[model samples]
Target: MVDSLAKMVGSLQKDVDKSSRYAFQSDYALFIDQLFYASSASHITYTSLLATKLGIDLSLNRLVCLLYIKDREGMPLADSRLLYALIRTIRTRMTNKNQDIVGLLGTSRIVYCPYAETDFFSREKLENQLQALAATLANTYPVIVSVSVGLYAQHVLEYGQSLRSIPAVVQQNTSNKSGSIIFAEDHLVDYLLQIIPKSVLDHFLGYAVHYLQENPVVYETLQALVCNDMDIYSTATQLQVHRNTVIFRINQIKEVLSLNPLHQDSDRFKVILIYTYARTHLNKEI
Candidate 1:
């Protein structure tokens, strides 16, 4: 009788331990989510203090890998496998043992926040890693997920812009690429296009297409310029041409378009709007 009672007590204790082990920290997750939305100085400061108290290291670099589980038809999906993989992924990559805050937002949103060393991340590496992960997930799991590894934020405060911009990125870039996650950072032109009216894009796309067909190199140069953030040196390197040649092309584009994108901010925005629309939407093959 004594042995049986001891065994029963051990079994109950094991069950209790297992339950607590898997329990979701709703309050912690919610607090982290709200901190991303925090903007004002006072509020941000308060959140930072709260974060410190909770053992969240405010010093490390933070980046979120978004697993927007969706079907091939561009529909969001609900699958337990997504959560399963997400948890494992975070656990594997989590740098801080005390700071793993995974946000389980709406049905479709399962976020993993990983804090790493300050000198650890770069944009190109993050994108490549996400792409590899997406492929691996598709092959490893039965559920269909459109994985577009998102750009990581250097600070938690920067999460607001990234999170807000993702929906538009997914909507605009998902039509042609199924089983691939489209990101706002990757299709930044698409993100820019969404804010502008369809009528404006329509008006400018024609001019962009005209130039794309006339001198494909010109469009190519412009695309390189935009991609390189209008640096003549970088654009020249990308095109493998002289910086003078890049400058000449910029002048040529300016003379023809009647706008100078290199110098003026407004002109840069307009030309960017035109460049992205033509490259992404019109299918002109520039």
Candidate 2:
């Protein structure tokens, strides 16, 4: 049964990569449904296979993987050396008896740590440790990490499905005034909206809400610049916009929103996040 399921999963993985073909494959949907059902049936086998595919050793019995990817808008692009160093550091921590870190995975400087438990106390401690490790890494590495925790257990498949829906819930929380989703401890969708100035939120939502209506060329230019940390002149040249015009639009955005584009990195990051959420889930865009 395991071998047959593995073969089916491998085939499904291949199909997933062939977007054009898979899009029209009725069998693909059936395959996905079956895969999830299998995952729920034997979560350990599924998670073990997932870890193997990602080239990580799953030695821990009760493990949870916290995947950390760089936030491009707020951090620099990752480098190979930095990623290696991070993996080494995490491995050392995981092996430490006090830390109880089990294994580490790395790809393009994104780190994944599989731990021994999902108990809230342990998870919170792990998060703090990871944050500290990230800070230490940032001093030398060029990237800043954003973590998404995925707890593993007998019901890991169910948990994984819930985690996948987080980005969607976050989007809904941002757009629907009446909608509420708990993003973090004591932080709900309505809470974030209430804390941030209404005018500022409106300014961000203005650009994000009507992003599709705006010229794709301009939108792409802005997104690339924000994501890649490209210089204004270079971005303008790529977009075929005059440098002065780029400055003008940026200035207008800052002035109207009462934010200084040059110094408001955190604010800019929030706006970019909203833009990303809106773009990825266009149908749910509020």
Candidate 3:
């Protein structure tokens, strides 16, 4: 069964590349999932083979993302095993043609593209380049892509380590009401939330969850405030409400959660943590 499944996956991997240039095949996801769940013995071997064939690191993060990519489709992630496979092909084609930086694909969809200081002068320029890449991808696949930029490092592995905050960031970036492109440099505080353990993060945010069930408006306001860097004006502009109304909503969040993110830096981290936790668990955009 394992050998048969492996052969099928290998053949499908080839077909994935070919189909990506035209229109993505959606049927392969079920086949891959079947291969994935056929046997515990086969899972590691098949995952490794897929990783090796696609030139991706078999990191735990990648494994988890591969599992979740099925659900993230059209939700800023688009989906499928072929998603990562297609991303790998894109990276290789770009490198072979010398059109872009060689990116690192940590999972089925997230491609960490490293750029130099000379790549673009401003964030807008870098974003334009990334959007063009997204356009290329959307041409073949029917999904919008989100990008997190301004990541830097001296080595490739170190760059991967820096992406610890990315899972949370991507969720937020894709959830953003304004745009799909997220500049990590701009949202440094939310990145710090990654330092907290998941259990602790969840526990800390549990208050907000409870409060949100009764008052989802407060939760929505909190997301707007944090995603907008706690700027009242911007939050109001985005939420399409009066600045005073935004402040009142924020005050309500502070009162209920007993966390004044606007008044203290530490408290701000807690708020970001709660927001990240909620975003991941609640599947609701903040």
Number of the predicted model whose lDDT against the real structure is largest: 1
Write candidate 1's Cα lDDT for 1-286 as tens digits.
9997567546643443343323454445545545556655644555565576687776566665566655555566676667656556646654465765565555666675556555666666655655665566556654445544344565656666566657656665444342465556666666667667778777766765687678989988988999899999999999999999999998888888887988899999878877877876676566
Ranking by lDDT: 1, 3, 2
RMSD list, candidates in order:
11.8, 15.3, 10.5
Quick one: best TM-score, which candidate?
Answer: 1
TM-score attained by model 3: 0.45
Off by over 4 Å in 2: 1-78, 95-119, 122-124, 148-156, 165-286
Cα lDDT tens digits for candidate 2, 1-286: 9998879777655544443223453342333232233443343454445545544443443333433434335443455565656666665656444324332232442324344553433655656765666566555555555544433433435434434433433343332211111223322333344345657765757565465335455456556556545367876876787988777766655654454435678766554555454455344523
Deviation from native of the Cα of residue 69 in model 2, angstroms: 5.0
lDDT of each: 0.65, 0.47, 0.54
| Model 2: residue 25 alpha-carbon error in angstroms | 26
The local lDDT score (0 to 100) that residue 217 gets in candidate 3 is: 85
Looking at model 2, report the run of 10 residues with the lowest lDDT sum.
175-184
**What TM-score number comes out for model 2?**
0.36
Quality of model 3 by C-alpha lDDT: 0.54
